[model samples]
Target: MNQLNRTTANIQTIRPIKVIQFGTGNFLRGFTDWIIDMLNEKTGFNADIQMVQVHGKRPATEVEKQEGLFHVITRGYQQGKIIDETRLITCVRGAVNPYLDYEGFLALGENPDLEWILSNTTEAGIYVDESDIDPSQPPASFPGKLTALLYRRYCKGGELLNKALHILPCELIEANGQKLKECVNAYADRWKLPDGFVAWHSRQVHYYNTLVDRIVPGYPSDEAAEIQQRLGYCDELMVVAEPFHFWAIEGPEYLKELFPTGQLGLNVLVVPDLAPYRTRKVRILNGAHTTIVPLAYLKGLRIVKEAVDDPFIGTFLQDALHSEIIPSMDMDPSGLEQFAQDVLDRFKNPFIRHQLSAIALNSVSKFRVRVLPSLIGYIRKEGKLPPCLITSLAALLVFYRGRYKGEPLPINDTEEVMAYFSDIWKSGEPYELVPRVLAMVPFWGLDLNQYPGLSNAVIREVRALLDEEKVWLV
Candidate 1:
């Protein structure tokens, strides 16, 4: 028997219905679609997931050629031991490029079978400018495109309010579903769509604020050959992620009855609020990443696995997250600690080699969003600056020094910050720069001088690191 072509060997043989998914990239295939496949297997949900490309740049021809078949390789801790599981996820019935197939994309709304519209268009996908959204193209922004589709659906269904989709926005921002809903309303007004249609949309559609967590490191291109050989089969859409995953939805309990995500043992939930979960994860896991990355990488660790595997670096990071990071969070401490532990475990997963460089993307914005808040929170809560996060801030300044472990770091920062650091560091009085940098009110929103001893603390640690110059990183 030919193993690859065997029908029973595949997992996505479910009856094709309709699920218009935005962003058909590896993250979705490996993360959301993987869970959908499992739900199908366990709950007998006849689901059809049709993905549409969010951007026009990525060529969809090759991806379409793969015939919607993919493999998800899950590896990490299971019952205190390492386990790797390979599951063929075959639920993607078809894929459409909204940028290329504008007609087809709009027509998806007309399909009465289309039940849900799921999206993971990243942090920037929700905001849609009606003017920029080429009427020809499915609109530039995710919300604009979605709004256009919803309008069409309303018209096509003739006020069939029942066909409105349950929107699950898997974006990174807080209140993503709510934001999307707001944008849809904005589009209706901007495009001058009929009032009945807008009112009908208001009545028909439902959007839930969601929080999805999974270490979808995405495609394992470098290890694809090895993975394929180990599995004794080939998969074009193979995704490697840690075993730990979470999906939190903010909505009524009846939503679960419709989606049935929990039937498959998924961590999916329908809660009154996802805010607490979001706060906990963002502060601990995301805060740890931003805080640890610059420090660890500057100390010479390349990948997250190494950063966590090495005794000193790993222990340092773990301490920082648990002691400093978790304590700073306003959420329940015990629950936050548990979540942090799971996050650490996910970081240590052998399956995903999460690169430090990749994590370092948009470091300036990252520090502002993920780390700075923790530092401020720690000070507010404990009446003193947290050591680890403060140290991480010092590390960030050092990392921005435009050099890294005998290699050019290619440091990217705003011209203002770069010039400020450059002008200050050149002042011959080098050690004073640390205090000056800390005292720089414009850099941080609040004055560091008000922090009692924060400047001295940062200056002392940064100077100590520079003076000793020993690589404490993994």
Candidate 2:
């Protein structure tokens, strides 16, 4: 398959598109669709992909041109070995545009075989909208569109309310599908889509809150031309991903029988609770990521791979996770340490050169969510700031400077966080600036100015990290 260079290969067996995917991005094709193919291959429970673009006019038209054929290149450490694997993904039969093809969207419900609804429209995809009620051409919001399709299905199928589809949303938000269902129900009540119809949907559709983890670096434009030459075919939707993957769906135990990822060795799980899993990622993995970005990038590194590869920076990241983030977390420290180690290893994956600037996106919020709690928790527990974490905080503040050595640096973040910190930068000296920034009660959730030692510690470290380019013992 690698030598052939043919990006698209016809699946010898055609399974009806039983799963309606709300996203057609590289992440879905590489992560979820890849898992579905493996399930089909091993357990003979074949599922086909019917992708619905999340938004815009170009998406539906753009995806359809490819005839739903795409590639998934997994580049990372797999089972203790460095692996670079590519597959011609075949699960998607076609992508439908709800904007232009609403009847086509609703008509899928008429298919008795339809059982699953999967989505990874990113966190931004789910929104509450009060407009667009034409059953013939669904609305813009995912919940509204889904409700419209479902309502039309209810009318067509004599309201077989018990015929619920297992909907698993893979967005990163809390209670993803539950929130989505709430949005849909809001629309149902607002538009008066009917009492019985709402009952059927409420009863039948099993909306599972899911947690998915994977790093899908989609459409390698910089490497596309050379990659295409290597592959021999030009694929418009070719996506590259990490060897790691996870999908923890929160629902009844019986739901596992329907998804069946264990038999296939895929990391996808139907768990009773995702809190522990969420914390593991939030505190450990995401925590480490946020902690390292500024410290490593400001030290003249470009990507995560480099950040982890450099001895001083890498050791700082490892120490921060173990000494600070893990201890602060409620999960088993040993378990978190292992997970953090794996995350660091993944960061060093030579095949996938993950850009640090990409991770630097919205870093203020990233630090606030991923690193701040750990900082506060560890401070209360140990009575002082953690070692390398302080380094990251200092580095993060220094990073928002928008310049280093007179060269303009790219610092991507939400306007509010950026603007908030930007005001601090102009407040003057590096010493006073630290406290001024930390005083954002909403940012830190408390008066950081009150923490006398902690404020001074941050100021001292920020000046040191900027000077030495390393946070450890100088």
Candidate 3:
């Protein structure tokens, strides 16, 4: 089979590069690049991407080898039926490693057609690195690199008005675009860059905080050969993702006309605020995952599909979401219900083997961020402990004991958390264990024992699980 490339794939039109993407990773390719490709084909948007390597000393070898051409295999359940679709993504014209070719990377900013900057450098990428003070050299952090690029653009454009670029950061962190801009400003202040450059960055440039959702399991090594054989080509950068995708961008209404993703019937939403959507996802999708994983794993379930397919565990998850999580959030009830249903359907996607143990990693922290808010909110509003949430907490503590049914559990957490659980479980008493765990301020930020009747409620469920070896459904 021929290697997947522009020529071999018969991609003719070389669109003007309008976007500079900061990570040549699977998630960006499967999500943003895919969307851009859609715009190019469906809307005549005629924009391509120039990917920049944000981290790692090595070059973007796979991108170079494939000539910035690859396929996205979207396999999952859609509308109650299994669907497998493949599309050759040709929006990425090429990639450049800033670490290797600093001049070439900076040259990207000089492009007159470039208007948007997109990034997904993980949550930790939006930070100021004081070490990246040298404008002559490539900066150490993502924001620093962006500052360098923007400064170049500012200089190239003669510091003119209305020359600002749209920065869309897809990092999972809250206020991602604001945080990235702050990092850039910090870099400028620390480096003593031109005052005009700072002014242009602040006044002209637009930074839109974005929320992106898509499960891109990149580079399916296990099924690579079969996939390549099926496609009749060898694609080094092939990315596998689910059929569902959403990009909620917090920006002005005019951005809709600029990006025009909504015009293509995509789930991309340009809203005045991303909070409700973010909260909806966090409470419904993430909260359900965090709440169900440990309990399902304890029930001898291995993967998410199996867990959700099981009648008892599935009902538990559904009740936990609709009854407790969704009701706590201040959102449209109809929209919330639909989102919850979509989440449950995504979990039941048979093509994706989402391991419970994978989701269980650092579950303590995950529970605090993902599940605890809704759990607390529901209690505050209803003036009673949510039975399913309390049971999940109880199951979490039991799971931390590190063994179930005489088999070792895939327990992964901070050493301090593991040690705390190990020391607490030494007593073999649920009544004593529940209060101590609830009072651990470092884990929960506040002593959860102070919540009215929360400790007692959790203790009851803990004792039931300890005695019965299963979640006692109330």
Specify the highest-lDDT model's number. 3
Order of models, best lDDT first = 3, 2, 1
Give per-residue CA lDDT, model 1, range 183-275, as digits (tens).
988888878889988888888788999898887777788887888777676656678877888889999988888889877777777899887
Instruction: For model 1, state the Cα shift of residue 313 in Å.
Output: 1.8
Candidate achieving higher lDDT, 2 or 3? 3
Please give, for residues 311-379, the per-residue lDDT of candidate 2 as tens digits. Answer: 988888878877778887666678777777678768878877778888888887778888888988888
Question: How much is 466 displaced in model 1, in angstroms?
Answer: 1.6
**TM-score per model over all chains:** 0.89, 0.90, 0.95
Colliding residue pairs in candidate 3: none
Q: Rate the local accuracy (lDDT) of all candidates.
A: 0.77, 0.79, 0.89
For residues 290-328, could you state the per-residue lDDT of candidate 3 as single tens digits? 999988988889999999999999999989988999887
What TM-score does model 1 achieve against the real structure?
Answer: 0.89
Q: Distance from true position, residue 468, model 3, in Å?
A: 2.8
Better of 1 and 3 by lDDT: 3
| Candidate 1 Cα errors over 4 Å, as ranges | 1-16, 57-59, 130-137, 230-233, 362-365, 404-407, 428-431, 470-474
RMSD of each: 3.2, 3.4, 2.4
Candidate numbers, best TM-score first, in rank order: 3, 2, 1
What residue runs in model 2 are displaced by over 4 Å at the alpha carbon?
1-10, 58-66, 78-80, 133-136, 158-160, 222-234, 413-423, 426-430, 466-474
- TM-score comparison, 1 vs 3, better candidate: 3
